[model samples]
Target: MPLKYLTADQSRAARGLLNWSRVRLAARSNLGEATISDFENGHRIPSPRKLAAMRQAFERAGVVFTAGGPTLSNRSAGEGGVIGTQ
Candidate 1:
């Protein structure tokens, strides 16, 4: 599973919307700190669970996870390395 899409800005905005520090977000999402850090720094893609937690966190903050933002399905496709394969 390779990541297919993640504009740097979108990743950053997601972090902001979650209102979580990198460490805190990682802990809350039950992901490794390095993993979350990598995603924030555009060094690595997040797993489906991590992506879902991020979306949920954003939703809690009143941020709508819509087409304009990163989406669970998009992340899933990207992670599965099957973007456009359907």
Candidate 2:
């Protein structure tokens, strides 16, 4: 099945919820910071592979994207340590 990419707003919101910088997400997702910045700024749409990489990175860090918005996983939220990376 094709993966659903996060919208620009959701991508920004997800990063906000995670308190993650583009650099951090880039490292986690193995994507360039410029690509992430462009995507978040609505300058461009990422490819399926790139989108999947970013989404997967967020998922691994306990971010949950919902129809409403992005949220922290219960486990991570309860722990009060949603900061999954440096």
Candidate 3:
């Protein structure tokens, strides 16, 4: 399956669903808070490594991104993904 990237809307929703603030996400992702701010605000697209950091952090917090409906998962699966070399 092709990877499902985090759209800005999804990013915001996911954070809310996880009950996390941007600061928390940044801490978990090991990214600067400003980076997270820019990403969420659509002012920037994170680099692949940074994006992966964000995705993995969210996954660890039990936020799943699925192709179907709004079903959630508790899996700590963080594999087979690449945000590209940007």
lDDT of 2: 0.72
lDDT of 3 by residue, 9-83 (tens): 666767776778999989998989999899889999888788778877877766767655443444445422222
Q: Clashes in model 1: which pairs? A: none
What are the per-residue Cα lDDT tens digits for candidate 2 across 14-48? Answer: 67877889999899999999999999988998998
> Quick one: how many clashes does candidate 1 have?
0
Q: Write the per-residue lDDT of candidate 1 for residues 36-78, one digit (tens) a residue.
A: 6787777976767677675454444444434433443433321
lDDT score, residue 53, model 3?
82
Better of 2 and 3 by lDDT: 2
Q: Estimate each model's TM-score.
A: 0.52, 0.76, 0.73
Query: By lDDT, highest first, what's the ranking?
Result: 2, 3, 1
Clashing pairs in 3: none
lDDT (Cα) of model 1 = 0.52
Q: Please tell me which predicted candidate would have the highest TM-score against the true structure.
A: 2
In model 3, how large is the Cα lDDT of residue 42?
Answer: 90
Considering TM-score, which of the candidate structures 2 and 3 is the better prediction for this target? Answer: 2
Runs in model 1 lying further than 4 Å from the true structure = 1-8, 68-86
Q: State the weakest 10-residue window (summed lDDT) of model 2.
A: 77-86
